[model samples]
Target: MAGGRQISENKKGLPRRWRFMHGAYFYSVPPGQECMWDGKKTFHLGRGLPEAFRKWAARMEQPGKIHTVSDLLERYLLEVIPKKAPKTQIENARHVRSLMAAFGSAHLYEIRPRDIYRYVDARSAKTAARREIEVLSHAFTKAIEWGLIDNHPFKGQIRLEGETPRDRYVEDWEVIEALSLSAPQKRGRRQGPAGLYQAEAPDRPFTWGYASPAAGCEFPGRWHSGAVS
Candidate 1:
């Protein structure tokens, strides 16, 4: 019975200026008004009805409202986030939501570098704030790419709390303890590694553990020479 109705019939009960087509919601640009829609005839909203409405609101609302940071974030989440890896999609969603809470209502052009620095300072979790700012910065970059904004506010902001480098020399006992905790075990035809291979250098032997075995699990060099026999 649903197939018998005209294409227009299925769009009934939908919001004004919205259409359902090709199994997804779309928005019709007013006649002779393609300039307002970036020269597109019809915008493919999305498959999900609730999400379609959200995108519709972002597009159909007042012109000023469409240029808000929140609108940009919504568009990014709708258009960019889905193409990412599954774990990345989840993390980016969390970051975007946090950005929304901070700068959602602000107009895109009105956000400045100082405001971003202030947001960074206010956050107790500096690491999380850095990640959120990275997402926001990329959102702004995409907004510029989309012609929604002319500039990015905080792309190169300094992150004070970075990951600790593993340059410190790891003690032999530390490596032994780590190996004790999760050493490889013999399985069927394959045997567990006899020992890790260290390079010929004696002064920096432990650093190899932090990096990689010089010869791999087979230990064909200094490790067999007397290091781990």
Candidate 2:
């Protein structure tokens, strides 16, 4: 009694439910069965895709289940968060906590796109809201895979407009000119040590610090203070 898109033939050249990325093979869980795989939305099957297919086939024979949005959140916090990168694990945990406050007690299928939009609109931090919704959307995706729900309510529909990136990034030529202007002055003060320091010294202080004696000079503080010439 599974719902949503039917399983189709693999036109992407790889096997059905299988994906290759960053030099590893991944198996997308069957809709409504992620709980069986300990809440992993996709199983990392290793670098060699062909051999990984056998592992995928064996895991596909078994299926598992879940209860509510909170149930999903718990499982994700327990099973999924530990597997992510250190920074991402912290971010996802915060996102999950925010989501739990809003949708924890609700049933998986009961969530709608409108509910998500309302959440987005109500949140004061648009960028943070967008990130939290991304986590929520991914949870719904896992819900569909685990067979907890037949359809994702807010997968691609909600758009939380975040702050734009600042346009005033420093140019490479500006950096080169700054370095050029500072170099001769440094050489004038300390001839031998300053001559050893290159234009790239300002970019990598710690590395250059151990590598060159000039790094011991007050150049680190002077450069950081934006004293060019």
Candidate 3:
């Protein structure tokens, strides 16, 4: 074998009659089989095993036939998925399904940023689309590390949209009104300043924002300055 070596056992515990390997390329054959090989002609182990195995091994030895997006995804599922967290594995599986549905048939080298952009545009949720691309990007990065692909399609090509922060301001009067309107029983056991502050604190300020009022109101009871409780 030009790019392969022989082994006594297959991936399973069962004994393999003949196994061959060469430079990341290998195939198994039944015991005492004679196949023609000159390191130039196509390798063939005569009929007995699945036809796909024969075809795949033959293609694996050829430089031009290597690295399909589908194959990379399959490898990622097998090698990478197990190491991920349970929630992450579920998420990645969903992303992988989408990726395969779109680009599984394409070769890894053939996929471009434009194809990815199209996929992103087709998605309804921008956040979800961004996550999907991120997952695919990670898979492509793994492919590059594994030497399956020379470059990543997403590298420096895709830009995710930024999320804006929200700021809300609540006036002290609104909080006081809400507290006054709430029933005495709903205000809990205490009728003191502590109880009113405690009852109002959870329901109001945080929902809106808590800032000192421009013009403060006088409290009916003793209350600390700048403190809700």
Candidate 4:
């Protein structure tokens, strides 16, 4: 206890158990537990500090074992991607690659909401950017569950643009007209407007019409032919 400075001499009014040393306050626990105070009113050296101290000590011993964004992405790709559908795997892989290119060198804990927002802003496609952030958010959640990181940077921060649903209705005649203009391909039988309309309207009666009037109309002005107005 030679180097143990007394708390009474300090004007800050900290408890006697707390001692200031090397510009930080440390609380001394019974049975030889010394925990560093984060100066935010939280005591890390109090109850259950031994386990935390042990983890800290272990981390100190290794030093280079800190997980980075690239590491998390690699683990996610290896462990989680295989469980998803083939199409989903491809899509998620693309998103992860984009994320890795940006923050792969940064530590998982160092990434913040601003960095994610920057990435979102850099992308030209709003929907694709949203999807990329969504994938990154899921990966960060998995990283939390895996004990790689403590929190998600993108949680509650990502805002995707609203998608407007198409309300235009396609009349039967418009579908017929559009299909009539489409020439059949030489290699295979083409699905005409009637055939396409039939395929799209199997679940509902055609009287109510299809919600997407532009489905059969490839021409620029064809969508207006069946306008509800």
Best by TM-score: 1
lDDT of 3: 0.47
lDDT of 2 by residue, 189-212 (tens): 333221132233334211101113
Per-residue lDDT over 24-132 for candidate 1, one digit per residue giving the tens place of the 0 to 100 score: 8888888998876678889888875556656665665444336777788877766666555544555676677677766766777667554554565555576777767
- TM-score of each model, in listed order: 0.44, 0.43, 0.43, 0.42
Provide the lowest-lDDT 10-residue window in model 1. 202-211
Write down the TM-score for model 3. Answer: 0.43
Error of 2 at 129 (Å): 0.9
Maximum-lDDT candidate: 1
Q: lDDT for each of the candidates?
A: 0.56, 0.54, 0.47, 0.47
User: Is candidate 1 or 4 superior in lDDT?
Assistant: 1
lDDT per residue (tens digit) for residues 32-93 in model 4: 23233333332343222223233233322222354777777766665665455544555666
Model 2: how far residue 22 lies from native, Å: 39
Backbone clashes, candidate 1: 0
Model 4 pairs whose backbones collide: none
For all predictions, the C-alpha RMSD in Å is: 23.3, 23.2, 26.4, 24.1
